[model samples]
Target chain A: MEEVLRIEDLHKSFADLAVLKGIDLAVNRGETIVILGASGSGKSTLLRCVNFMEIPSSGRIVMNGRAVGRAVDGKQTYSEKELTRLRARVGMVFQHFNLFPHMTARENVMEGPRTVLKLDPAECARRADTYLDKVGLAWKADAHPSELSGGQQQRIAIARALAMEPEVMLFDEATSALDPELVGEVLGTMKELADEGMTMLIVTHELGFAYTVADRVLFLSEGRILEQGTPAEVLTYPTQEGTKNFLRGHGSFRLPEPQLD
Target chain B: MEHVWDFSALLNNKQLLLIGLRNTLILAAVCLGLGLFFGMLVGAARYSKKPLLYWPSTVFVEVFRNTPVLVQIMWFFFAFPIISPFDIDAFSAATLGLTLNTTAFSSEIYRAGIRSIERGQWEAGKALGMSYGEQLRRVILPQAVQRMLPAFMNRAVELLKMTSLASVIAYPELMYQAKIISTIEFNPIEMYTSVALMFFAIVFPLALLVQRFELKHKAR
Candidate 1:
């Protein structure tokens, strides 16, 4: 499979503190990479950097062989136009759902196609319906984001991104804000996308889903990828001490065995 | 020992009052329409990141808002004709003053409405590949405009009241007509009372309608 995204020596700093340090990774077409880490581990920053939503302090992001932002005198640079074009190919689903409150679900889904793709209104409406149905939200087509439950809103958000037909999808803790019961529905929808071979880079702490669906699992610690491997190697048997500690904190990722007395 | 609250003279001059009422309404509507247009531009400028646009709009809003409206009216009516090469009648002066004053307040209201929106909405638009202009038009403004409507309506009512300030420039609006009628008829109480009632009749209903609209939006 062709490589869809590449990050080289990415670094991000705010004032005096560093958030991401010398990060390097590559995502292949149709590959699902789950970034698992504790809070402040810079997992979310890495996903944001790929789309140039948060510009990396040094190094570069190449999406489908094109540099995301410009390079001036060997220094990375960004413009509104450049970021916008990069964002078109990289769809993002936020943790908060972030649906446009004033628009209906169908309208929210149609917005990208109409505004970015400049699709005809009728075609936008048709595609919105198609994507809504794909997310099992056809019945709620006219419902506003405020009218939908958290899960439904997240599903519509996913469908909205899907309508863009992006080369890559980034999920930034997409289910973290959901009620426990609602988490499964969103996870199920995402699992379907993964099963269909959608290229995805996800920042999440849902270890169970990560174990089953992730093609590769990257455990980040203090702005660095501490450990990464297949689910069995990373989840079932973590090699690094930090990964082991994080898995132990989750408690469910350990082998099924006798309890301590 | 006895006093008669007679309104015959004012009543006899109903045509003058009607004309005044008509002129007042026309002035208010025209000024409001123009003010809202300029205010939208000023508000956009105030929110813009570029200092070139932001500073001039900021100074315009602050200067108009802090200075006296009557001073502004006289400056445009009296001093402006002297300072500039052009000329303007009392009616034009009144309209310019009222519209400029309304623009300052309306721009502030517009700024508040735009700022009240969550940043996440803008992020959502950007994440969907929208340009800044597209994001503002399709996403932010639609939501912001809903919030701005009630405030805009209230400002319209306030602008209607401020139209009376045009009387200082001898513009033939409601207050100017009332002042002339009172001076000629020597019934200041009845004439001014009538003027106050006319203002109440127009503005009270407007306030109630805006209040109702605001409540409905809050419920949503």
Candidate 2:
């Protein structure tokens, strides 16, 4: 019910080409916000810049009242170690899951608490087991990411981040890389998290899931917020030419299935 | 002329032969041990992105590997004394030379093995909130060690054979010790046969062990 994240005037560029151009946004605590946009619309970059994974050329970002991603002035810079420490409180679940191949799911989950938080072995193991169990991965705790299915790997990745006990979690196209059948399991887990009052920011194109689950749905176009409202408002009524065109562009078109010939 | 082969020569002077064998073992053990340590450091240095760090390590490997081991021996035997104002024996110089040479080659071996590991290992560690040192210790090194074991053992055998180079340095190790006894007594074949057998006794088993380990790892 309270504002947990705020972004203003976000601008990002790679060489001459601009990716994100002057975006502003806010999310309340315990709300799930799904960001929808086509490829190269700067949605992913904006998500990355929000968490300071990719530095914004210029912007303002505040997460839980701590300046999350942007160094607005010369005075607000933090060292690499300090930034890593700060990131522990605001977890980012990558699009690819990015689970460590060498470590077991349990160890991967325990690593954050053991290293960054300096939690002892017993406590780390306990929390890791708890979260892994939460994701229904208790049996697969000893398995490596390579040994798990795509959906299972993503779930473990989410559990790994959750083990850190972060205040806010960011999901960057979490289910984009999954098989069609596997997508549901990961989404189901996200729904469970959302129901538990978790503050989550998700970048996804799963329109049905977004409509059913998201507290607020944001339409990103050309690196700016084109439209944003409750899912009921934006999905059905719709507004803004960019938003309408973006939806119509996707809704009217279906991928051509390969012929058996 | 002796009427029959003198296998007893080895049995009769077994004490002196054992001492020579100890010197040989010392050369192989010390050089290879130190070589592996320094090699891992150089290997890691080579993999670093900065040209300043990688180039010097690359140059060191090239200079030692391209040049002959015998020449490296002579350089240590002759030039090491001049380079170092402090006087040390040929044995020390030879040991140091062999280690540096082995390090040059083994570092590259290790570098290849380390590089062969998938990049995903590092990404996973980073995503887990691990520091670089922790990632290396927990994830990278353990997996790399498994892959590198065969190459490391092969380097050990190479180091073992390289101990023969110490004969030129007046260390009186295995080959030199045999040469000394043969020069005194006219039985060249007997003394050299014993030395060959000793090398076989040590190295052949180790080489076999490596092969077996490699096969088992493949089966896995």
Candidate 3:
């Protein structure tokens, strides 16, 4: 498998607090990596650094064989223009969906293409329609975010990201804000994307979705990866005591039986 | 003995009052346009993190906001011309005062409006790979402007009324014209009353528009 994204010794600190300490990761093309950690364990921070939302204190990030930030005296310096371009190629979805409330679903989907790619209106509209249809919200194209349910809005947000045609998509607790019944639709849409071999980096608390969908599950603890392996390995039999304790804390989750090869 | 109320004085001064009305609109329009435009810049500056921009903006906002606007107008009229290179007339003085005042107050409105939006919106924009300008113009401002509309209308109405303050410096706005007419015709009651009514005619419609906007926003 070709490595599409590589992070070397990523570190992020906010003032006196160290959030992520020396996290090294590599993501292959078409791989879906599910990050499981308790809140404040640096899970979201890791995902954020990948897209340069939160700049790493000291590290190297290589995406699609290109360096994200310039190396100056052993520290990474990012230009706004470079980061902006990087973000276009790396899409992200948020917990609240964060759809532009002023815009309709189709317009929200059209925004990235129009602004970033400078595509013509007709082409932007076409991409919007195609992506919205893929996410199964084509009929709700004209509806504002306030007019749609949480699930429907999230699906539109997905379409908005997909319209950018990103090399890898980052989902930052995409369905965590949804009502229990609404979670399935967003996850179902994600599952469909995974089946289509879209590269994704998801930071989530949904153990069941991770168990069934992830090619590799990583358990993070206090700004470091405690354990990582196939879903059956990490979810079923974690080696580290921290990973075991973390999984035990989530007692409500029941993992599905692993498929026999 | 009952006081005789005469109505002919106002009709006699109709042309003078119309000129006053015209001046009032010119002052309000000029100030409002310049205030809103500069207000956005000042607000963005105040919102900025760099001390070079932030401290100066904070000082500008605080000085204008804390002091009475009448003092600002009088200062521009009586005090500024001593050191000012340009000619200071009634119109220029009033325009400078009101425009700066409106800029200060409206800057706060812009700041608050922008702040009221969630951080998630900004993050979402950045995640989409949009530049700061793109994010602000395309994503942040569109939502913020909607929330800011009623406040801005309120500013416009207040600004219209505030134009009367120019009368202290003898600018030929509606209130100043009314003062002159009242003195000549000895009809202070009628003159002031007519002025009030005229202001209400202009301001009441704006007030209604604000309410409609609030209702629509709430419905959304």
Q: Which prediction has more favorable TM-score, 2 or 3?
A: 3
Cα lDDT, model 3, residue A235: 91
Extract clashing residue pairs from model 3: none
Q: Write the per-residue lDDT of candidate 3 for residues A131-174, one digit (tens) a residue.
A: 99999998999999999999999999999999999999999999
> Fnat per model, in the order given?
0.83, 0.33, 0.98
The whole-model C-alpha lDDT of candidate 1 against the native structure comes to 0.92
lDDT of 2 by residue, A52-80 (tens): 66667777778777675435465245466
Positional deviation of A23 in candidate 1, in angstroms? 1.5
Q: State each candidate's chain A TM-score.
A: 0.95, 0.92, 0.96
lDDT of 3: 0.94
lDDT of each: 0.92, 0.84, 0.94
Off by over 4 Å in 3: A252-261
Backbone clashes, each candidate: 0, 1, 0
